[model samples]
Target chain A: MKKVTAHDVARLAEVSQSAVSRAFTPGASVAPDTRERIEKAARKLGYRPNAIARSLITRRSRIIGLVMSYLENQFYPVVIERLCQALQRDGYHVLLFISQTEDADEVLTDILQYQVDGIVMASTTLSSALASDCQNAGIPVVLFNRVAQLGAMGAYSTSSVTSQNREGGRMVGELLLRTGHRRIAWLAGAEKTSTSRDREAGLCDALAAAGLALHARGVGNYDFAEARRAVHLLFRDPASRPDALFAANDHMAIAALETLRTELGLRVPHDVSVVGFDNVPQAAWPSFDLTTVQQNIDEMVDATRNLLFDQLGGQVMARSIDVPCVLMERGTVARRDDEPGRKPGRARQPA
Target chain B: MKKVTAHDVARLAEVSQSAVSRAFTPGASVAPDTRERIEKAARKLGYRPNAIARSLITRRSRIIGLVMSYLENQFYPVVIERLCQALQRDGYHVLLFISQTEDADEVLTDILQYQVDGIVMASTTLSSALASDCQNAGIPVVLFNRVAQLGAMGAYSTSSVTSQNREGGRMVGELLLRTGHRRIAWLAGAEKTSTSRDREAGLCDALAAAGLALHARGVGNYDFAEARRAVHLLFRDPASRPDALFAANDHMAIAALETLRTELGLRVPHDVSVVGFDNVPQAAWPSFDLTTVQQNIDEMVDATRNLLFDQLGGQVMARSIDVPCVLMERGTVARRDDEPGRKPGRARQPA
Candidate 1:
């Protein structure tokens, strides 16, 4: 098959090659009638302006490198979809990289080869060295849903957007306490993640304020299998089993709910109550109906885009924005006024 | 900040500019010690070879355009992660486009401008005209998890890798029948999707072979809320309620299970049996122990990668490959020999 070129479209439309190029170029000055004729001819010939050539001349690729991990968690996929849609609306394409390993230096190096205009590290941490490398290369980096521990010295033009995980945890703690729960156990996600640590800290702080201590603790590593195992170990001793459980994230919380009900043959809210963080889509289902903290994904995505665009437009300031989370009261927790033998209240409709 | 160029690296490293270029170029002849020296100086000076300039010279971007939709469905995230890993292993990057609308023509046009080497349309249909345009442009396109109804004339240069939806549906039918289920209902995905239609057709074919017909039908639109509504409608009349339910995908199947057990107050496998396609990770959870048909995602991904690479290597033939699905027997279906009051068998260990 013969390759369609600008010259072919120009000849067919009876216009110069430059005119055909101008018609394809966005924001380029072109007479409306001539542009229409050129577009018609281009359509007939299936001609497309080579972006590689145009990028070389403009020195901009209009592409962003999105580095993410943990697609299995469900929440990450929602965030990724929203981020991609937001970026596309702004005329930027995403070059996606799924990091399978903890050290993203190698993946970051490979992404640099593509000359992406900026980097969005969604749910993944960026090392200070790499942050500095990006700073020196004039590439902006925005950390989404994760924060860098790089102190002021290493804060090299890296911005971050995160949910108020600690505050969300505190809300969950207060809800569980107000519902008349005493034996409250906590399930943690990956211990290394800032999200897990901050949430755990907030829950602890809230419990301490209420003159109550966490009855038990286990690590789920943000995985279903690990969470199931954690549930079994936490509930092994019948005499001391928890009256309520709070998980660091929804995936683990769902796993705990299933394990407690199916394997342990325990009734939710009557025998034990459960609360989780990150009110994912599954939390609203009839089976789980888990009360959780809702992370405002849209706001986080908007902040991330604004930060990247601001950096691209020559505003180089590193800042962190924390969006508040809302507590979604659902079916898992027992109502304070309910009799001991009565059924739990129906799940509240999402507001 | 000033941009660092090859000349700067050469001057800093005390090497020829050609030697510096060769050091950065893969497979180019450069002494190992001299290469190390050049790399060190380049790192210090922040000098990296620009991909846009190199692509202009070589006429290859080593990038693949991955067009996808429906990330909300859990199955798709697994597939995306696997496909991205496979492509990255072969030294290619993914430029991801999430199609928010039915017509992908605009997205495809934008992707083409980036000069991607090929495209993998995962679970998205390509218009024949766009397929022809890609062919004329010498860009290979592979339809992953979907089949093209493009008549022989429109086949142009498109290949596809898909699961045997019909055979899988037949397997579901046989399993339900063998388990003594008489009245089986099916909840389908979006009507226009090939995955939905093919699975439904195969299911009907199997039931017809058994001298029976599908007892009930509902459209879930491949969504949880829709599936929950479908479940309620199907069970509204207890006298004629379905004895078995089959959902075209796992997400809807899960919704049906939750609705039946929690809202409808029906026991699974005793009052009704359930089966779903796509053995997503959640199927193995103890609470949902769902019986499903497992699409061999790894093999499908491998086939998709090979197909795309072959097309990029100048192979012009368009072929359709149907990978088989396996029936994963779990806790959702009753054993044929069990007494009417006995509990369903425990879920089988994943092989």
Candidate 2:
């Protein structure tokens, strides 16, 4: 079968080939009636304007390179789905690159080969060298849920979107302190990550303001197994067992809850109050009923999308967006008299 | 700065442009010392071969359209990550399309415009018309973890890779029956899915061979909320409350377990035994300890990769490959004397 081209559609629709092309090109100027006629003819003839040919002419693939890691984390999959949907609405498709921290440079090289219009780096850090490469290539990159830690050089040249991690941590700290928790411990995610560091800093600040210090701490590497080990070690010394524990993320928090209850035989909010960040779907399970800081994913996604577009439109000077987090009070945290009347736990809602 | 080209690299390395291209291309012949020179020069110049231009020359985008839904299902995220990694190793990039069931056609149309070398439809159904369109377009498509249920015409023209869902379900039925659970209920995933249908059929076949029938059944639509509701309705009447519940997938099974234990105040395996398919990470969590069928994801992924390549290499005549499932004996199911001495549950292991 001979491939149907824009010429065939134009002839059938009684329009110019350029008219058919404009009709197919998103955001292109075309009369409404002409677009309708061209679309009808193209559909009838099974004509799909070759995106590759158009991309060569315009130097715009309308494809975004999404470099992501930690798919095991429930939160990331949600972020990925939302980003794809949001980007698709703007006529952009995602060229997904699953890369590890050490391999970011290699993956970035591969993405550069494809000449994706923009890049979204989620939950992973990029080296300053690669960031400079992206800048040189004129590919707008927005870090999602992670902040670049490149030393002052060209740092502000890359945009980022993240939840206010330190504030969320402070909220958890204050809640724990108000609930009469004298000894509080923290289970940090990967120590190198800015998200983990900022949240810990906020927790420390809150603790300092209350004239107390963190009783203990452990690094979970933002994983379940590591968190489980942290829980075991944290509770081994019953004399210094933390009255309240906060995990850097929900995955670790859920794992901690299970270990505390099943293995350690501790009652949540009674023997040990627990809180987590990123109110992932599993956090709301009735069995867990975890109190967590919600990261406002939709807002963060929107900010990232807008940042990429702005950068693509030649807006220089890197921007960092901080979306607010909400503390979801659930069964995991104990209630205090000084505290305001807590809303009913949102456990019953599906994630 | 001017963009570096193959000609520049050749000039710097003192080699032919074809030799420079061969050095960059995977599985291409290149003299060892000359290839090293070309790579060093390319690195020095910060040059990347333009894949878009090469794609035009080769008429192969080297991009596979991965149309998927349900990233929320933990299984899919793992699948997506593994597939991306596997495809990357084979010199292909993923153009991810997140689509809803109703919009498969629109997504397919967009995919066709990009002219991806092949398509991998994961856990989502496509209309026969779209399958025919793909075949007509000469784009080889492999349905991953799903079977095309296109009516008689052109049904056998598409390839599929799936776990033996019916066999997996039959294993569950036999295990439950052996453990003396007479009053069993089945919680199904989305009704239109071939996986759910095949599993249900196998369960029925096993029950029929035992001179029994399904005691009760409910549709969970392969979602948490829907499964929670199914659990409530199935247990509403204490007299007919099912002693054994088999969920089509791990997500629904986990939801059912939470509802049964927390809301219904039921003891798993004592009051009710639970069995689920797709032994997902959560199934092994200390709290759930769900006995389920384990789909060999690695095997399935490998088969899918091979199938797509074979199809692309002009191997016509559609084929369907079924990888086997293993029944993981965990804590959720009651033990039977006829069964071998099972090892202690591997719950402490990380998901």
Candidate 3:
């Protein structure tokens, strides 16, 4: 088959090659009648102006570099899919670069060579140095669901969407106080991440307010296997075991339940109350039925898409979006009739 | 920050701009000593040869357009991620186009202006007309995880490593005969897809060899919700339900288990033996403990990456591949005490 060229379309349309090119180019002026003719002829011949050639002169490839990690979890996939859709809607393409390594600087160097106009770091695994380096390269980057220690770029997080972690912690602590459960434990995610740190701070603040304290704490690395191990170690000696347990993420919470069910032979909410953050899909799977603090994923994605577009349109004001979170009570938490709040197990009853 | 140019690197290295470009270009002519000096200078300044400008003269862009769908499936993410890593390793960047609608021709037309060297259809959604149009524009495309009815271009499938439907059906029939199962039923994936068709054919052949037949068959649309609904219909009358249930994928199997457990109060492998395909991550989770057929994903990925690279190296061998599958036994299936042919899965368990 012969290659179809812009010249062929131009000849067929009875116009210069430049007119054929202009018909494809945005904001490039040409007579409407001639432009229509050129388009029709190009369609007939299947001729398209080479964007790579044009990119040489314009220096804009219209590719956005997306750096992400933690795909084994459900959260990142939702964000990546929505971001791809929103970017594609605006006549741009996404160049995905997934990494599991700690050093973001090495990743940054590779992205810079691609000459992407901007970047969106949707993974908490991203290094602060890489974020700063991208800004240093004059590329606008917006961090999603994370915070930066060094003030180099824009960031958007949903700290407000859920009950203030500290306040929620206090409520739980006070409830424990009322229930006469003296000892309690906290099973948290890794300490390296800001999300883990913030939640821990909130839990401690609430405990202090109630004149109580977390009897034990363990790290789960935000995975089921790790959380299971953490729980096993925390409850190895019956004397030190807490009457209640709280995990920073749902995977850990689910693991804690498995440990409680298999190892200690404890009935959930009857012998020991439990709570978890980031109520994921499996939380409602009947088997787990965990009570958790729900982070509205759909709303978070909507906000992120808007933030990316705002940056593109030069909305450079220092803005932070606070998303609200809700406490979802299920079979995992103990019932208290006297407590002035929504009851547990409300969502779990079979309709 | 001022952009680092090849000229800057050349001046620092005490060489011409052409010499600096040669240092970066493989097999390009430059004195050995001069090339070393230029490379060192480029690394220090972080200068890259202007690939954007280079594309204008070469009439080839180191970009490939990828039209993809099935983002919600775990299978697609793993495939897309691998494809991205493979392309990046080859020094080529992907211009990703998300094709969700039937009007995939618009996506092709939109990408034509980008002058991509080739294309890959990782989507099950794009129509034949759209695919042919892309070919007409002089871009060679290879369908990944999809087959072309017209055979206009290259394609690779699991035909090489796995048994065809006829062979697979015979195996199942033989197993059922040996195990003394009287009645069997199958729930399949989307009827339009070749994967489903092939598997279904194999199972039927096995049934014929045993002088038995499929008691029932239904379509589940390769979804968990739909599979549950289909299972509900299949087992509405408990007395007449088939003793053995074979779900084509693990997602469907999990859904079936949930439906049977909660809705019908049926016990796994006791009242009804359930089998599934694709040993996904969740298959190992304690709640399901699914006994499933496994396709070696890593080996498939390795083969795919090599095939794509060979194509990039201009060795377009329009070949097909088929990876073999293994039947894994766990809590989902009844113990086959009589069978001596089954491979020991106790050794294959992931550590």
Candidate 4:
């Protein structure tokens, strides 16, 4: 089979080769009827404009380097699908780089080599050196669901889109309080992540406001097995066990729920209330019926898209946008006042 | 910061520009000592090779177009992460395209326009016309976890990698039968998907061998909400309720489990048993602890990577490789003989 060329389409469409090229080039000027004719001819001859060759002249690959980790988290899969679809609609393709480690440094070299027009780091951190390198190289970078530390970025900062983590955490804490859940426990994700830090801080703020402190804390590092281990450790001493457990994310919360129910044979809400951030799809399942903080995925993804395009379209300053989150009230949160036999301050039975 | 060029690197390393290019190209030969000096200079200058320009010269983009649909399913997230990591290790990058619809037709135009060296269709189907178009364009396409219809592809066939879905389904059927499940219902995914059709067929084959048939069937279209709807439909009438249910995949099975336990207030394995294919990570969660068929993901991925590379390395024949699947016995299945109060053929109480 002969390879279809621009010349063949040009000849068939009765247009110049340059005109055919212009017709295929996005945002290039060509008469509407002539462009239609060229497109018809190209389709008939099965001719596709070579994007690689075009990138050489335009210096735009139209590829966004998406650095992500922890696909196990249900939130990310939902975000990834929506983000990809949104970007694709804007005629941009995603060059996916799965960062095995927490930081994006390892994959930075490969990402830069691709000459992508922009980058979106989701659930992955970036170092000061790499952050500056991206800026110096004139590539736009956006951190999704995260924010860069002021000290980490130094003079060069990357654009970021994040939910109001601290505020969301406070909401969760307050909800637990309003439902008469004292002796609250906090479950943390990876220690280094700003998300975990902010959420914990928010919960602390809420506790401080009410003149109450965390009963206990456990670290899961945002992993399922680790979360299960943390749940065990948190519940080891039944006498001191928390009446309410708040995990940084739904993944950990789900794991905690499983351990509490299956392993310990403890009843949710009745015995202990549970809350989590990131209202992942699993949280809504009838089996779990988890109450969590809903990070507006649509609003977050849209903010990310805007941040990236703002830079790509020649906007100068790197900005950070935080979309507000909401609380999802579900069966998991039990109002202590409604329980006929149990008092708010009474000691609960051990699992 | 000024942009670093190959010439600058060559000058700094005391080598020719062509030599600098060879040092960066993946299989291009360069003296070890010279390459080391060139790399050192490139590092000093922060010069990364332009993959876009190289693609133009080599006519090999070193990019695989990964067309996937249904990221909601926990199984695909696992596959995507592993696939990306493996391909990156092999010096290939994945250009991700999310197919919004069931078919890959819409994304195919953008995929071809990118001139990716190869394509991997994961949970997406291709039409015959597009199959031949890819073949004529001299591009290799591989369907991961799926196979193509002979009639659809005409003379142009694409390679595929899949687990033994039929055998897996049969195994599930046999397991349920061994547990004394008399009325076994089958829940299906999308009706058009080969995965769903093949699994249903295999289930029927096992029932035929046992001198029985599917007591009832419902289609979920491999969606969570749809699976919930199907579960309600299957169990709506308690008199005709199946003693055992086999969902085509773990996602649907999880949904069915949630519905059965929470909505229908039925005891899993005591009143009815549930089984699913594709032992996703969620299925192993203590809350689900699903009894399902485990498609060896690592083996399947390895087969896909090998098949793709073989074709890219000049192998002509389109191969179909089916990795064997095994049954994972967790907590969901129950032995009917163990229940002293009930018989295998007794009617279940209505929800």
Candidate 5:
């Protein structure tokens, strides 16, 4: 026979579930007759409210606390949304904790009273001690986007899709060389992330193959304003301005285009060709028409969803998945033969 | 003196709060010395444990189950994001339970275990029985977006802010009548949502004021393909063809524009005028410089955030807030002198 839960007992007794809960709860009040009838119905139905019954035997809350930060980022939203949906699909109701300003200790304290099943930290820079605290209570934590110092615990690590960062950088380097560009400028995302480090290594590999090195480089912290500032620095010494600009991501590329168009009043491709990764919706806008590398969001999302399920279901999983990237050429670059503009010496000179 | 919380002990012990929980919990093990030291400190500090103690004395999970849905919509991500953040900030980690196109009873089983403190129905159409199930358990559910067939106990409702449809329709009606449009048509979203209803009603009011009625009308769901099909139906019989078209929302407007431009070879405002609402970023693109009503998303987000906080912090709040809208006139609407290129007798036919 299937488990006859409290809900079934409530139905059989014609009393509310809370009435049954009160009947089972010591010192909790229920009308005398209703309590007798509930007790009678419970015996007849073989109702096993063991999870609640266990509350008296072992005071476990069974609620899992989840902390997700950075909802504004398109990537985080979709990921968190999926995580929430999947967790809900499982038996666990997530108690959500969000930190707006990296308030780690406060976030940890906020959920302490509720006593959750476990905590899943999404987009956090939480210290190792916090993770220790959650697990120290015999609660396992799974970190998403952020890493934990302890490797034994579960963590859904996100790496770039496609040929790892080193290979991706090499592809860009080879493409630049084939197009006969010698001097290049590179704009990188925040130096803190492992992603930036790997991609940088790959780019160096490609540039080294062509017997050339990056002429100008700057870190943009993976944001538009920072990219704009970095680009401005590149232009300060016009003598070494790169022929082509390779930004870490599309947002930075769009910023470069905006600065070039409105500020410097330069026509794209003719003045400075730009390339970016992650072809966000705006990259295809009639204005920018940027060349980009696609990072298979569908595959990435699928992998994440599946991994989360595997983890939830107690299935062991490998540490990471490297999705591949493919170059998408739009209107951003120009061919050498077509480059006859104002300055003769300035013609197709790699920065 | 204020009661000392778990955080204070966790800080003093240099252990996580869950450690404090595990220490106090019988059969919930911690190192014996660690448990003794914590017990000593807590007693010395005159700190009483919180809800879990009461919950242990009684038999309650102290968890609030949440039933959430909706993912495809962009705003949903942000909504859930903030909801999760706020709920977490309020000391509740959402036990994410999601069921996609499956029997809800199957999902409810997961929630049955640690009978929750309350239930918050963020998204989904919960029938009366389900609502009662929650209410009877003394679970207060605050519904978001979806209405309660059973008079809802607590609800945060939305009022249409994107253009008072009737006013906007009337504005278009007056402009069309003044510019001499004898035939005007309506393209509408699904009849289910209140948004569609208000806009349609508003349109009818405007057209009636000008002594004009819709020459033809078609219905479509809020999707590009569906709207495209609805617009196609409007052109099936050319005899009742409209001189102008008003789409319920911007996506539908863009669909109509694309069809009119690519398939019908019609010039905007000259051959047919078009208007829409919710000026999404795509509407501002040079290719589709559509006239639209702007829904103040920022203000709406602010209001929603505050409302959620009010509810979380034991404060009652207003049922709903209507943000407001603005009509942006662009290249799509025609003027008096501009009608020279249109049909001769059709000049200035009201609405």
Candidate 6:
């Protein structure tokens, strides 16, 4: 069977071929009645306007490259689904690229070939050289959950959307301290990541304000298994076991909860109070009931979408947006002074 | 700066423009020395071959449309990441369309406009008319984790890759029976899904062979909150409570585990044993340690990749491949007679 074309649809609809093309092109000027007639004819003839051919003429693919290295962390899957839905409403599709390497250099090279109109980089990092390469190629890029130094030219000219990581970290630290926890331990994701580093810095800021230091620290590299192992070592010394533990993200925090409950035979908020960032859905599950900082994913995704479209609309600017974070006071954190069989006002505060 | 083109690369490499195109095209023929020269020229000129233009000439977009409705299940995110990486290795990119509607018709229509080389539908269903539309358009589609009937012409001529869901369900039933649990309950996913229905059918098959039937059943629609509610209703009547419960998928099963432990205060494997399908990474976490069926994702992904590429390579055929499932024995399932204060041989079997 021969393939249907716009010409056939135009002939069937008693309109010009260019009219049929304009009817199919998004944002093109076409009369409402004409477009309706053309669409009816095209539907009858099973004709689909070729996006590739139109892309060559219009210099727009209406495709966004969504680059990520992994999805083991549950947070990204939610963001991905929402981002695709949001972009779809604006007449664009997401071309997904999962980076095989730690950094996004290799995947970006492959994505550059696709001629995507824009890009959203998640769970990956871009080098200054490649960021400039994307800039030179006229592709707008929005970093999700990551930030880079502003180069002389606005740091490769890529925009970023992130939760206020350092502030969220400080919130967790203050919550832990306000409950009369003297010994607090920290669990970190990848040390190099801005999210991990900023959150840790905020926690340190809170601890410094109270004239206390972290009692212990361990790095999990943002992996479940690594978090479990780190939890083991951090709590191995019962004599010096921290009263409270704060993990960099909900994924690692969940892992710590599981390890503490099952492996160490410890009761949460009793033996140790724990906190995490990114209040993932799992944090609210009754079993975890974790106290965490909410990253406001909707706002983050919205900011990312706006940043990308603004650049695509010919604006030459680079900006960093920090969405505010709210701390979810759940059941995981407990008041140390209110221990069972003890008076409520006698817990020692850090000196 | 002027946009670098294939003409520039051809001129710099002292070769024909077609040779420069062939060097960039996967599987296109070009002399070894010519490709090297073209690569060197491309590198020097900072020229990346235009995939869109090449796609028009080759009649292949090298983009596979990956359609999914939701990523909450966790299983699908893993599949999406793996499939993207696998296709990337073969020079194919994934165009992701997250369906806002329950079915795939709308997203499928949008995908057709892109003229993608193929498609992979996950976590969504397709109607017969739309399936045939894809078949008629010569775009091969593979349904992941779902199966459909063989229509008069092989069920719209789309391929499917799935686990042995029915057999896996039967295995769960047999294990429960062997351990002396007569009162078995079932918590289902969406009743309309083949994965859910077939699994339940298989469980009934095992029960029928043993001259028994399910003690009770509940539908969670494969959602976390719904599963928690289903667990509440299923366990409301203490005197008639089931001894074993099987959930159609791990997401719901994890929710059930959390509800039973926290909300119901029921001990897993001690008061009531539990089993789940799909053995997602969360199933192995120490807090869960769920006994479930393992759907070998690697094998399923490999099969899907092969089936899709086969059709792309001009093989006209409809095929359904079922990767086998394995029972992952863990801490969730318990032998009835082995309960505390109960003699090992005292528990009665169905007979």
Q: What CAPRI class is candidate 2?
A: medium
Candidate 3 positional error at B314, Å: 3.6
Residue-level lDDT of model 1, residues B1-351, one tens digit each, is: 455788999999999999998998789999999999999999888787878778878878999999988798899899889989999999898999999754477899899988899998886877888888888777888888888866568556478998999999999988886776667799998888888889988887777776778888999989899999989999999877778899999999999999899989999977888999999998988878999999999999999888888878784687788899999999998755455643232211222
Estimate, for each residue in B1-351, the C-alpha lDDT of model 2 and write its tens digit. Answer: 256789999999999999999998889999899999999999999999988889878888999999998787889998999999999999999999998772377788899889899999998767887888887777888888888886667454578999999999999999887776667799999988888999999887787777778889999999999999999999999877777899999999999999988889998877888888888888888888999999998998899899888878774767899999999999998754343432223111222
Q: Poorest 10 consecutive residues of model 1 chain A by lDDT?
A: A342-351
> Candidate 4 docking category?
medium
Q: Tens digits of per-residue lDDT for model 1 on A236-293?
A: 9997778789999999999989999998999897788898988898898777899998
Reference-based lDDT, residue B160, model 1: 92
The CAPRI class of candidate 3 is: acceptable
List, residue by residue over B83-195, the lDDT tens digit for candidate 5. 56655544444555665631244555466555555455544545555554543444445544433333354432321122244565566566666767767788887665546
lDDT digits (tens) for residues A1-351 of candidate 5: 144667889999999888988897789888899999999999786454755455434545555666666554444545555666655555445666667754366777656665554566655645555554543444445555433334344343222123255566667666765665656788897675555666667777777665567778988877767888988888677666677788877767887887776667667777777888767655664457788776655565455555544543443432455667778788877554344432323323243
DockQ of 3: 0.41
Q: What is the interface RMSD of candidate 4, in Å?
A: 1.4
Clashing pairs in 4: none
> Which 10 consecutive residues of model 4 chain A have the lowest summed lDDT?
A342-351
| Segments of candidate 4 deviating more than 4 angstroms | A11-15, A26-37, A337-351, B12-14, B26-37, B337-351
| Lowest lDDT 10-residue stretch of candidate 4 chain B | B342-351
Evaluated on chain A only, model 6 obtains a TM-score of: 0.91
Q: lDDT tens digits, residues A77-103, model 6?
A: 999998998999999999999986558
For each candidate, report its DockQ versus the true two-chain complex.
Answer: 0.64, 0.60, 0.41, 0.72, 0.26, 0.72
> How close is chain A of candidate 5 to the true chain A, as a TM-score?
0.67
Q: Write the per-residue lDDT of candidate 3 for residues A230-277, one digit (tens) a residue.
A: 988888887656767888777788888877886678888776787887
lDDT of each: 0.86, 0.87, 0.67, 0.88, 0.62, 0.88
Best by TM-score: 4
What RMSD does each model have against the real structure?
5.7, 7.0, 7.1, 3.8, 8.9, 3.4
